[model samples]
Target: MLEQLSSVFFDEANELLDNLESQLLTLGDNPNDSETIAAVFRAMHTIKGSAAMFGFTDISSFTHEAESAMDQVRNGVIPVTGELIDLLLKARDHIRNLLDAGAEVPENYKQVSEQLIIAFKIYVSKNGGNASLNQPVKKDVPKIKKEDKLSFSWRIKFRPSKNIMKNGTRPELLIKELTEMGTATVVPFYHALAPLSEIDSELCYFSWDVILTTGKSENDIKDVFIFLDDESKVEIEKIDLLPGENNRIGEILVDRKDVSREELDKILKEHRQLGVILVDKNMVSEEQVQSALAEQQHLKSLTPGGQVATPQSPASTQTLRISSAKLDQLVDLVGELVTFNARLEQEAQEKNIAVFKSLSEQCGRVVVLMRDVSMGLRMVPVSTLFSRFRRTVHDLAAQLGKHIEMATVGAETELDKTVIEKLNDPLLHLVRNSVDHGIEMPEDRVAAGKTSVGTVTLSAKHAGAFIMITVKDDGKGLDRDVIRAKGIQRGLISENDNLSDNEIYNLIFQPGFSTAKSVTSISGRGVGLDVVKKDISTLSGTVSIETEKGMGTTFILKIPLTLAIIDGMLVTIDNAKYVVPLNAISECIAYSMPAEEKGQRFVTTTNHGKPLNCINLREFFNFGKEPPAKQEILSVYDGDEVYGLVVDKILGSQQTVIKPLGPLYGNCVGINSSSILGDGSVALILDVYQLTGLIKNSSKKAS
Candidate 1:
């Protein structure tokens, strides 16, 4: 149990650290934002508290020092500076290392931690003293009444729930905290205790009535019990003391002439509350005093902090943290269910029974809904992946002496968590390339009629069934002449080859192709773009580049929302079945041989009243026999280029559960993965992007 708890704490701490880094980066931009400062301080404080609870002593101790430093910033003693944020960010990273290492202090980390501590001490000394680290600065408490200089007194009745101790709360610790404010006289009541024979040793039956005399406001007292739930009945009532003040219920009744002073005194001598006495003696009705008491409690519950102590509503939704492995398993099962449902629907249609058809249709709807919900469960906002780039951009800009500003749009666009994880490295490489190669120095940018600070905009939007993520930089775009020259020098393209600007820009993704003049730590290795292309291709995604000579460059990545299942257009060539992603299909046209295009692999057809060039899939996949006399041309769009994929027959669309092809055929060209059809046969899922590349290469070879 302890190990499990520690693991949970470690996970939560990592998340908090990520949040801390993000907030600190934001604070660097908006230095004077008090809310961000407070948030940073709170995150540190939470990590420290949880670390201590989980027995991570090293982390707890190290974080306390950083938390104290953040406290100074929070209290406005030290203004937020880039140097300070840098230190805090390093501290955050060190704390993560500590958590990762399970509180074991590695030697290298110890040296770094000591250096950071010394730096913090120097900053503290320069400010004033180390007093802030040792003690909290007390805020001046507002006086309720200036004329009345007497200390306020509160009568607190705390009746703890029987299972309060089960949650690891110590009542004595709370009482001790109360005593720290001022004089506190706690009187325990044993009236609710059961007989010894019937007692449960684990349960708490004691209640406390305390008279606390202090200068602190009621909020100060409430803060002590903030962790307690609504089941713990706590009531705080102020005892008024003034010359003409009717301080007690009986006094108020007598002052209102509802009770005689003799009756009040006689009932009070019986040692009961004045309200109960008045009600029993018929001086005032029960409802009247009850209403007054309720109003008094309501007023007292409104603390000086301006927050009411209302019971937490249980109707609020709660979230449980489950392992990602479990979620992946569930998604796989859902995929299987979808595949099975497809087979069932096929069977129902073949049988042509009315009842079976009706049931199958209804079941199909439910299965589709279930598949959507299950996939949605794995769909998390891309912002979680995007936020990590802020630190990257900040550090890289500073190191390269470039002024760059990053702006993100559609960060709330959601994708499968698995896809986001795989995308991180590719996105990082793109951003790095933009900063290092695309973005010019401040002086150069200014001379080029651009803002001194280059802007890199990362945006995402849903394009059909795919999410289009684009990383664009308003800096020096890819120089087509330079890229073409490099391509020729690298023997990637012939000097006489005719390529468009887009095509020239894409040559950067060719293996060992780079236009960088020299190798630096940042880029110029010519490895990142190729790896990005390969990774995205493996994810069944496509990448395209758009560039202008002087303005900027944009790399757009089109990826599916999920990889488990897809709506695919099942087609057949010869006897083999193939599945083409529906998202890639534009339209289908009848194959016609133009007289001038005889023996040509691509035919010019009109789509939306414009000429379109389509690739014949049957010939591309090498269907050894003669082409069918009447074949359908499936026009598919790869980026802005529309091409035709000729098929012997279009078998409509079906939900395709993508199953990975083993390593034996891993290098198979133009086939991304395999999917199972309703008849228990396999269909090759075409890699449209790779197929386009193949066609381009084949055409180049023929030329």
Candidate 2:
């Protein structure tokens, strides 16, 4: 199959740009780290090279300028500084815009590009020496002359590190790129690998003996190992040629002067370094160095731009360049499989045959495996989402003139690609808000007996089946009095009404709410935090805040692992059916009969708890029909506490594919999204958090 290589380039370029922006911002704070300097250099290098391949000529050209600057930092020719970092950030954004232009040249983008170049050159002039910031014009990259080329033949042996794949390089892709360089033949060397029982999937154990004949110099071949030089073992040597040079490897080697008579005799006697014998004896000239370098770079580019040496595993996997559409199709197939498995199992039980029943059980196992494989395809690390916030926090902190440090944990946590995509904007807003509004100024922090450097921690971890992503900041915590006063002024609450701390903190998420004494460009727009809450809740997730008077504040978001599918607890209320995410259900118990007080009945106690207020399903719906004498109360937890919701009956569990509620139901409260049952019934997925909010609001109004 003809592989589309540019997609990988785009994906990688984007990731590098994100890393570049984040690291540059961080370097602005601490510019002395040699490690971070190298990181910035690598990110720029990858973006520049990949952008070239994807036909992002302007991005490649523009990013080359930044890469040139970063390369100087990497080599210690220039010192990292705040001014340098700021200029690099502007450069990063411009490169991003260029990449975003994708195969088209957008009008006025050139002007933006020129502006960025001027800013970068100015910073270079200021922070860099007068020996000429823009004074040293970049030299054009040298290229080989194909027609005048002298081809050489050699046997190259390569064994990559175990983590080459993890580093985003596939040996298959490397091999393919190598083949593109010249006439090549590959012989896979699988002799040294351990048995399957002792293998590690992360390791690359196999090696290859390649016979390649290319007009490119040996240096050209060696350059291919640049990024992998630290991580793998590679050896290339010229060999003697046979009579028919064009027809066979042996003949080609003889023509290249790789295997001398002495070397061949030594091979007959005892083998010696073939390339050494040929080159040291002046058989190959200084000109060969150029081709060798080109070939080497060509080879190195096939691997990841950066890697480190590691052990190999017996199970070497191959990477296929599959289109994302194929993955979507696979996921759809798996979804259908799950539905059919449910149907088959249901039918088998009716047949009551042991043989068919056993087959159904086996099919169930296969279905589970297929579902996992499909889900894995959609599982992208949350690290991308988390890494993005680093830049946001850094830029906003600098803008707001706060000394805040961001610490992230559990970044390796995985979530659905769709979830990650939708989560980025909301997460960005939250981190920005924390950096601007949550963290106190360095002087204020010191006065409060706290460290001068405040902290914003972005963390993700699995709590049961749900992923909890929390943004916690150490600053002057939320002031309840300020929020309460604002609420009264806005008529969201009565002046004398009593409210809990949680309620007061949550008011900040109300639309058109702001407690800032004076609005600033960075925040206090009165629209950001509320949008964050709405966006999160739209994912069937819950957002809550915790704060201490002088310590800090935390905004915790609880989201499901995937939105495409979920395990839902089916229930009925009146004539309407509803689905509650099984992950949120703490338990379900029979609601005890209760006495009526003012035309309302409440469940006093069911499971060793105090009298908990519950609404009769029929009465809550105002169905005008008598409520079911018996009720099943589902206890749902919203990350903080649990509440029982009364329903008519539990109709078992289902795999529900979430469907967004259309604009017509835009104002519907308590219903987060709708999903389709296998039986073609539309089940309204209840937002337990919203439902609890409804109960709280109703009780407050009554009191």
Candidate 3:
């Protein structure tokens, strides 16, 4: 159980670290951004609490110091500074290292942790921002006007996580912690407990309703719940009672939201004590009425004869955190359902039964809809990727002594989680390239008549079934001559090869290719762009560049939205089936390329216009059988290049659940994955980019 919870803790810890990095970068820019500041504090606080709970004492102790500094920063006792931000950022990385290192942290790492702890401690030590090793946490207490220091009354509903006891949390410790503030009456609710045989010793079945009279504000009370996870229910409300003998029970029940106002009014019509009526009518649980009565009695004592209930509002919709592994399992099940539906259609066709055919069609629609929803569950906003690179840009800028900022557009564009995961390395490389090489330094930028701060824009948007992600920078663009020289020096291309400017730029992706004058800490070693190419290609994607000599460069990646499924246009070549992504095809024509107008690897229309790079599927794959009398031409595109894919015949569209061809066909060109046909035969999914490689550059396109 500890092992399982530790896994969840690490996952959550990583997410919090990502959030922390992003928030810290934001706070670095806008020092007075209170919300971001508080977010950093909350993240640190949660990590500290969770780490302490999980027995990661070193991590808990280390993060506590950072949290203390942040708390003082939160209280406005300490100011945000670049040095402080730098310290916190280092601390964040240390926490991540600790999490990654697992149960044990090394002695040297402990020293590093202590170093950061001291730095955070000293950074906030000035102006009583917690200089001491044992400074008590100061709550944001409200000043009471009454003679009694404990002038505020609060109702706290706390339900510990079911596994809290298993995790070794003591409820008495919590209650004891709470009593430090002032008076707290904790009424334990055991109504949720089952009979002895049914109860699990490891599980916690208790909740509490605490009526506390204190001068502390809501924030102060919230601090007591640092032990709880986000899913735990902890509602804190302040009581504003008035002095009166006629303090209404029905009002208290309604305000507590244990009973609706309508139910209270309706129950009052019977007037046999509102609590008893509510419990007997089953308007609320007996425990709820008793808790309301507890509040009623507590408030009456405060006001000498009255109890006032604070108004409660509906809570936000809850979100469940299911691991991606479960989502993948669901999608795999959906894929099976799709295959099963296809089998139904095939059986219906073979029998030529009208009823079965109708049923198959209905089931097919349902499967397609269900498939869409299941896949949609895996589609997350690209902002998750975009926000992550902000730190990359921030750190690189500081390292390189450049003024750089990130701008994003269409961040809400969604893509499959698998694609997004694979995209991380490629995106990281591109973003680093943009910062290291693409974005010019401040002085150089000013001299070049651009802004002092270079901007790297990361944007993503949907284009049909593909997602187009652009990493653009406002900096000195690629020097084609330098790239050409590097390509020649590396033997990737000869000097007399006469490469186009675009081709010259693409040579940067060649292994061992570099335009850097010398090796540096970042990109000068000549290995980043090739990774971008290799990764994007594995996803059956393509990359292209757009640049102007003095302006900037943009690396555009066009990748399929999902690897699991596609609305493919199935085609036939030599009686063998293939699936072309329907979204990739512009149109299909029923005319062959005029033999006389055909170039080496391209074909021209009847009008004999510019040649379109064409790949004859039959000839490209060298199929045994010949094509039919008539052939079809699929006008498709890769990036901005228009191309034609020639096929024997179009077999219409299919809901293709793309399956990997496995290692045997891993090296196969023009085919990346396969889909199961209705009759249970495998149809290869055509990769347009790979097929484009089969088509040599045409004279018409070059000119």
What is candidate 1's lDDT per residue for 182-230, written digit by digit as tens? 6565666666699999999777888775656667788878988999866
| Candidate 3 structure quality by residue, lDDT tens digits, 1-703 | 9898988888889999999998998999999997899789889989989998999988888888888788778767789998998888899999999988877788889999878777777777764665864465754553223443445777788888887876667766777777777666678899879899999988888888888877677888888777676556888887665433355777776677777777667777885876777777777888887787777676665543222333334442355678999999999998888888878888998999999999999998999999999999999999998998998898999999999999999999999999999999999999999899899889998999888999999999876657999999988999988887777777888867976777888988887677778898897788999999999988878898999988999999988999897889988888789999898888887866555633333555531466565777776677745456688888886655667888889988878898977767778888888999878898989988667655645533655
Poorest stretch of ten by lDDT in candidate 1:
239-248
Best by lDDT: 3
Deviation in angstroms for 580 in model 1?
2.8
Give lDDT per model, in order: 0.79, 0.72, 0.81
Model 3: pairs clashing at backbone N, Cα or C within 3 Å: none
TM-score: the better of candidates 1 and 3:
3
| Candidate 2 lDDT score at position 675 | 72
Estimated TM-score for each candidate: 0.72, 0.66, 0.73
Ranking by TM-score: 3, 1, 2
Worst 10-residue lDDT window, candidate 3: 303-312
Report the poorest 10 consecutive residues by lDDT, candidate 2. 301-310
